[model samples]
Target: MRKNEYTKNYDITIVGGGLAGKLMLAVLINCGVFDQDKLCWINTDNENFKDVRVSFINYKNFIKLKKRIQLDVYSKDYSVIEKIELHNTNEKYPLKLKDLNNHGIIIRNDILKQNIKFSEKKIDIYRSKVISTKCDEFNRYLFLKDGTKIKSALVISADGSLSPLRELCKIKYLNNNLNHTIITGYLECKNFNNSTAKQIFLKDNFIGLLPLNDEKNLINFVWSIDNKILDTNKINFHEKIIQMLNKFFLKNNLIFDSPKSKDDKFKRVQTYPINVKFVNIPFKERIILIGDAAHTIHPLAGQGFNLSIEDCFDMVKCLKNAKIIGKDFGTLSLLKTYNNIRKTRKNFITLATTLIFYVFSKKNNQLNNIINYGIEKIEKTSLKEIFKFLAKGY
Candidate 1:
């Protein structure tokens, strides 16, 4: 079918059903932008829709989500995180979350999906991949793989790093692959206390323990090793992982328990190269990109999802205010405001995460000693507040 052949016209068509897209839909509905008949959500996958990727949401985002979305429903699948702990492999000093007088919440990607489902907005979900998108003088058209098309006043591309829509729209981006791999999975560890998140920095890689429900834990293992280490057939990756984890837990003197056999919920470790990118412009004509479509950052600090949610909130606020003032909400000038607000913040986070990775990834004796002393001083002083400010998505 031709790109403009679809019959349905939407006010806003979101091009991904991930956290960012769903949050944007919920925000529009909450703002009463349009009744349940104006939005279309498109995606290709039909899995639980919850990203195994976990996010540590700050206090501000927690308040916004509670006020604007369905928190009760989200809580069923996520955890309200009250604390976080950061450890340096060279020392015993650790930074604890309670020192900052702030708490972060953890939510699964699927929980966000459920929250968006509660919106009264008229949202239609299309189970087809977006093949291409085009903008003409009046409207934006998204061509789907199922021989269908959607036209909308505004098309928000939340389709992530390999965004087809962004490519189709010709949005220029700065891309860099950091030559790292992040392996994420869930483990059931006893006596986790459900209150603290732990991050351990080792010479070769990093391991983060995010406590979910009472007994379940989410682990993100990041390694900055040579790319050859990721070759599936050439390396005994699973055995290597077990060895790493064993040494990690042994160093920390923390007991490790295998996942429950009944639960057997563990899947083969998934590996993805870490890439960072920032769009020169997130909006063009009637097309705009949000979340990973606009920028992708290092996951070291777990700020990607929070940043995406903030983008959704900011876009809704700007558009709503423009509509109330009788301004052209869909115009490039107005859309540029959204990009401007998000770009600086995203860049700061991207740079900060990169710096953190560089500092801790060093194994030099002098740098390690300096890091150990810094950690000790941080634990003894108010420096933790600064760390929390960065981690809490300020």
Candidate 2:
């Protein structure tokens, strides 16, 4: 048996250093829960992140974070989205989402990672992998690969979809691959303003173009198509997509100017298999899962990241209350409250998005017409409610 050569203790240990994890750390630091030295963050590697990954934060969620955390340090650098335009294959008129108060802000993941400069001074960040975990009645312990161990009163797992700590807890869950492929990349565009987030629904695929910065010269594009159409040869896929988009824009009388070139390059075209996953219960013993670790949903509604943001805020609230009441912050009562609040919203969002995919994916002409008509009616009559739901995530 090995002796404990190095042992450290913290009030809270955060596993995973993704956006959600960082937001939690920032909140803890801002809320004055514990000094930076009293908290620990265990991450495998901080340098292995993509600068291209992005998310759209609803106005309400943005305000919430900005008011609580020091988000202004980096959030103001992104593009503010004022409108959302949705298109269908059969119609020339698009469904427009423009709310004066409930808009979205486009932000890059890299910027968010960099904005945490303020918190770097306080938290004990370990750049090592968690080899295993051990827990007792009162505290939880993490074993790192470098033969170091750390203990904490509460452990938060924001470790993305494939969380090792979640596995160690033996938490039963449901995971299903939808057999769809999502191709995401950045593209240069002309005749586009940075005020709108657009999604065009075609017969076989859905394309989302989000403004990356204020100039709107570059767009972050995500295309969700059938998995079978993915070609590994990389043969003129970029050209074909540009041509198709220009044609669609012309049909809709939208300005889509492209410079005629003999060779055009696409940056970082990556494919991911779409999946729906969530745990049955979010906590085991002293550990609680949040963000993607607890639930993941389809991108059809662009609510995955927003939901994760909300998760952080809600968790902070619950933990603060637990502290105020002088109760063990890691108690089952506190965790159950967090799980109940998140799971209810998660279920509602999952059902809504799944039904939407079903309705839009149907190939029957009559069903398509009916769905389009329904959407148009909703847009005209209840558009504000829709925008509110998307913005506030109720």
Candidate 3:
């Protein structure tokens, strides 16, 4: 038992083995605060991680990290999203936001995992569940289901939305339930261009077509269904998509039958209600929450994953600063620095998505006029660069 105790102790312990947690581990490795024995990862072994969902990666931020810290996130496997075209009902002008640097990439979850996992092989990995946690002033202790206790000076929770570590810290969130159900699935289309993604605003909800590959045939689709329009449990995705698009999008692109072989990944579908939340402060005592544990946003912008990456990088920055001063990085005072930065970013992103969602959902003449003015301002003025920065994280 003494040997077990010695093996389990660490300077930092990170929970949640998802992309956020792994990214945190990778950045911390780059920060050079702790070596192999001092840092550890606790994976939620219960999850097989259904990786059908795709994410919008801000390549500028990723490439910055890749260049500075040697992350392998940029490669030929990703599909570039050079432009985003937004459309609405009744002769609406598509709001076009262009990135001159081509800073956005739409990549599935699994490939992204491969890109970030290269440097994490040196750390101690625990494939167990954290059942309970206790903390003193200098260190937090995690009791795992696998009969081990981990003592760490700092605990970073990159766990999922329902983070057990956040609950233990007693952090509260600002909540907004959009009351819309989103259906995500792959669509096989004829001559689907992977360079430009499109969003169509219908009378009720919006549809997002995110490019998936260079072949230009497969696209990841996010269709939000207003609760009043249909039951979430009873969605027949392909038929409903055909019905939804034939009215507004027929001439723009053609969607064909998705490949439905058992091995065909495109046939998988995931449905979840849209809810947005943000923590006022995502840190307490010696623990900090990053990624989905810290905030949730409307998926229209596809900024959630990129925001998570920003969170991890910022947390590492705080830790590195604290280390340079020979101070405890786990202290609540030091963590407040990270808290302020991420909260501001989280607020700005959440509010932007909320505005876009509101303008589309409300569908009033006033809101329509407001969006039109905003889009025109973006196109005609230098605000276009700022808009691109906000959308693509340049």
Q: Pick the candidate with the highest TM-score.
A: 3
What Cα-based lDDT does every candidate model obtain? 0.72, 0.75, 0.78
TM per candidate comes to 0.89, 0.90, 0.91
Candidate 2 local lDDT, 175-221, one digit each (tens): 97766677776666775667788888877678888776644367777
Q: Please identify which of the two predictions, 2 or 3, would achieve the higher TM-score against the true structure.
A: 3
* Clash count of each predicted structure: 4, 1, 0
- From the highest TM-score down, the ranking of the candidates is 3, 2, 1
Give the lDDT ranking, best first. Answer: 3, 2, 1
In model 3, how large is the Cα lDDT of residue 296?
82
Name the 10 consecutive residues with the lowest summed lDDT in model 2. Answer: 257-266
lDDT of 1 by residue, 18-108 (tens): 7787677777777776645867888666665345556678878877788887555535466666777777766766767673445777665
lDDT winner among the candidates? Answer: 3
